[model samples]
Target: MHEPIVEFQNVSFSYGSRVALQHVNAVINKGDYIGLIGPNGAGKTTLIRVLLGLLKPSSGNVRLYGKNIKEFKDWHKIGYVQQKATTFDATFPVTVEEVVAMGRFAFAGVGRPLDHHDRHRIGDVLKMVGLDKVADRRVGELSGGQQQKVFIARALASDPDLLILDEPTTGVDVRSQHEFYHFLHDLNVHHRLTLVLISHDTDVVSTHVSRLLCINKTIMDHGCSIEFLLPSHKHNDVKKNEQIFKRVRHKH
Candidate 1:
């Protein structure tokens, strides 16, 4: 069997006395599109933070590419697209190309200038995300969806093997969300990019993600999306959402 690309073993975390995560264990294999879904305040963000090495687990371990996350120094191999509200700098005057180029700074060493290869990669990423036409536009001037795409492009500019996104489709129109997911699906199948996504839209998530993880302080459920759609589990509101996703997916 192939080794897991990301794994959490009995991981737990808390903010002061309030426990946020409790003995969570999961393994994400290569090329898996895993969806994390739950109601608000379910420690989804905390889990993502642990994977990113931004928050150390109070107990247990997080491993990336078969190594301890703390010992993994090559952060560039893991791309991240945080919630739009968390990272966008609206007043920044940088162009889309400039913003995407920032991804290389982590590898270029401090104060080093971008080389021709870096510029070429930035252009390629912009084109891949359909933002080449606006490459010269100031990032602050773009629409919310465009800005979100630029953020995704920036993450891809690093040529990461795995991409983690937190609520990537938020605030976008339905069409844009569909386009983005389609793009991600192609990236996963064609480029073999492993994707880990967290979203509140359970309906849409069920349609695109191969596996679903319902998290609320701990993992409520973790398995293939088809298991979540079984008739025995189809009565709850959340399950209804999953059924709707199945129907919509079939229609497409």
Candidate 2:
């Protein structure tokens, strides 16, 4: 019962002289919905990149599905929606179907056309994300929120057990933000897809995630969201640390 889907053991990373992360130790168990929150310049993104194997740690190890960081493979098992997925020019010609189909290719490999099963899976994910109606439309023509939905559909095309998204609702409208979170809820609730959602929006994050990891070059605090923000005097130290989060968010 000690198995974790993802593990970071004393992980640290530096961009040359600038230290981005420091001794980050964490574990993502199966079926976890984690909200990784921190202020700007915090190591949230750095930790994410290291987890995805985009950046090698200067020290310590990261493991995916219990494999050692250096030995892990099968990256297609995890889906990632990186920063600014909707920043493309409005004239870009790729259709929504084409964008989602890219995820199929990621799983099936280069030069392999979609078979019947692959096409069905593609259609199913599009419908699940509520983008089936606009499958033929140009992805760039959609609203920022709709485009982000397409990205999620693409990420789901592979039916990954784990999904990682960075600022998925960054340019989305307020209403769309709720809708997107609803879709995420469905994924985590119905499909049991584990998630690591990285954002600076504390209000939105604290509500959705099962666990909250507060990071700032290192972890400030982490635990269940309810207890993490509770007003209990017995947990005064934890409350004070949460105050640092509030101060960081309020500092403008």
Candidate 3:
């Protein structure tokens, strides 16, 4: 079997005395588009934080690209588009191009001048997100959907092997959501970029993702999308019991 791009082995995490995750073991292979789905407070965000190295597990191990998470030096290898309302600054005067160029901050020295290569990279990313015409427009001036695309463009500027998105379609119109999903499909299929998406729209996500991880406190299920969508045998048993109860009531 091919080695996984990201691995979590017997991982556990806690906040104060409450356990957020418990003995979670998962492996994500290269070029896999995975959907992480669960209700609120089910530790979806916690898992993402752990993967991003922002939070450490209390026990067990997390490896990225065959190295310990702590030792992984290539941060730019993963692109992240956080929940729409989390990081966008409506009052900021930065233009769309400037926001997209922010992805290069890690490569460019702080307070140092940008070179020709940096400008070209920024331009390329802007065009990729279809924001070239609005490159000079202030981010606040654009619609919510446009702003979301800009954030996506910013992440793509780094040309990451994997893209992790947290609720990328939140608060957008139905049409906008459809467009974003098509863009993601293109990125994954045409460009071979892996995607890990955390979303509440289970039906929509199931259509695009190759696999599904149903997380609630821990991993409830991880497998092909079809298996994830099918009602489990346990659920079928419950339905059978309900039917028996209805028959008994009608006969009485």
User: Which numbered prediction scores highest in lDDT against the true structure?
Assistant: 2
TM per candidate comes to 0.87, 0.87, 0.85
| Model 3 bad stretches (over 4 Å) | 86-91, 221-252
Residue-level error in angstroms, candidate 2, position 220: 2.7
Give the true-structure RMSD of model 1.
4.0
Q: List the residue pairs that clash in candidate 2.
A: none
Which of the two candidates, 1 or 2, achieves a greater lDDT against the reference?
2
Stretches off by above 4 angstroms in model 2 are: 221-252
Worst 10 residues of 3 by lDDT: 224-233
Candidate 2 vs candidate 3: the TM-score winner is 2
Q: In candidate 1, which residue pairs clash?
A: none
lDDT tens string, model 3, 194-248?
8999976655776677777777678864342323333342456666445433432
Clashes of each: 0, 0, 0
TM-score of 3: 0.85
Model 1, 49-70: lDDT tens digits are: 9999999899999999989987
Error of 1 at 49 (Å): 0.6
